[model samples]
Target: MTAFFFALVASFLAATGARDQLLVAGLRARLGPAPGLLVVALASAVATAFLASWFGAQLSQGMSRDASTMFVALAMLLAAFECIWPNRTPRPQEPTRSLGAIAIVLFLRQLTDASRFLVAAFAVALASPTLAGLGGAIGGGAAVAIGWAAGDALESKVPLRKLRLGLGLILAVLAVWVGLTARGLIG
Candidate 1:
């Protein structure tokens, strides 16, 4: 249950205005909120989270609790850094408007996203990959669903870069705290 909640909240925060959300929202704005697109996005989120959680489970098999906790903190630090980094991927020309293409793109984006990283970290810390994966899937799905539902309004209404920066800073602080606690340097 703790794993589920941690992954859910972490994934949701990490996914806000992320590349995947931007992709879904852009598609919705350009093509309308197609149900097929939403389905594909949800599928991609679930698949990516599950794969990450599985990888975390494998890693946790050999680590002590303290080591797993430290690893989770490291993961959080990585996520924070990722959020702070400037995005340089130029928007590609839409080669096709097919659902399969969209699915592939979304899945690929999630493969390196902060949400998946947090899901994996939580799974390692909690030793509950299934719960972590389910939570991450739901959280990621909700973020994309909002993008689909809001379309251009989401981009126009929200200061996404600011939000990302704020979240990144918070994650960085938490990571430092967690790392210190795991090392018995702080309570």
Candidate 2:
């Protein structure tokens, strides 16, 4: 039980990297200080968590612990590469439309996110996919809230280039940690 919750928190921290912080910041800039940002972020979190958990459960069914750990470690490694790589440039100027834009962006980004995979893998370990999914949704939503607040406070003062680099470093650390754990170096 404790481990399950720990994974939820870990997933939140890992998922709420610079990429998401910048994304929320961009969404805020586009929407112009609307209250609906939180709604969309939370909604997207719930939807993404549900899907990710289900997928993880399906994938890990009948898998051994070592295999599952390897799967998660590899995922973290991939995420490290994603974060380290340069981010995509913003598209041409387009007027903001509705909350759907925010939801879509959040959902798409989270579709194969490390956090979702972590939550799903945790669910497989705990044999409680629904609980893991719920916890992941809350954690993901909290991450968004944190990102929104940070973005709002730092807007225009900090360079996103630096933020992106920092996120890559964080993911690299996480990947190392996961790799070590897989190799029996960490508990």
Candidate 3:
């Protein structure tokens, strides 16, 4: 349960990264106002959670504790790098005139988000499969909701450069924390 909770929290924070917000907005604009969008989002969230849980379990079970810690540390470091060195040029906005197209875009965007993988893997490593799935569903769903709400606000209020720097720092800190915890340097 504790592992599930941590996964949930970490996933939420990671998902809320600025790049994801842009993708979701792009998806929403393309999809327009469609009821199917909700369904797609929910389905995507559940499927992602399930997959993540399974993978995380495999990783946790197969790897030594040191290996697991190293993997996570490396992932975190890479994430930090991406966050810090984001593409500076803004993507050309595409006009999404249909709901169906928007749904597809959103789904694809989410599929590529690192948080989905991290959350699922973390959940699996931290707890039983059932717990990991449940945690992922809850965390991913909440993250989508939060992203939807904050996407526009963040775009308007926060500078992308600043957001990236902050996220990079946070991810780095998390990597250190996870490494220490895994090594039993922290309780």
Indicate which candidate wins on TM-score.
1
Candidate 2 yields a Cα-based lDDT of 0.69
**Model 3's lDDT to the true fold?**
0.63
**Total colliding residue pairs, candidate 1:** 0
Q: Tens digit of lDDT per residue, candidate 3, span 9-70?
A: 75666565545456554455554534455565666666776776777777777777677776
lDDT of 1 by residue, 1-187 (tens): 9989999988988998899988888888888768998999999999999999999999999999899999999999999988887656654456357999889899999988999999999999999999999999999989999988998798789998899999899999999999999999999
Q: List RMSD in Å for every model shown.
A: 1.3, 3.4, 3.5
Candidate 3: stretches off by over 4 Å: 29-32, 85-104, 149-151, 157-161, 177-187
Task: State TM-scores per candidate.
Answer: 0.95, 0.75, 0.73
Expressed as tens digits, the lDDT of each residue in 1-187 for candidate 2 is 6535855785676555545555776666665666788778778888888887787789778778877777666666765666567767463256365678657877898777767766776676666778788888878878777766665555367565565467668767876887788789888
**TM-score for predicted model 2 compared with the true structure:** 0.75
CA deviation > 4 Å runs, candidate 1:
88-95
Best by lDDT: 1
Better lDDT candidate (1, 3):
1
Q: Which residue window of length 10 is worst by lDDT in model 3?
A: 25-34
**Residue pairs with clashing backbones, model 1:** none
Better of 1 and 2 by lDDT: 1
Assess the local accuracy of residue 109 in candidate 3 as a C-alpha lDDT between 0 and 100.
Answer: 56
lDDT of 1: 0.90
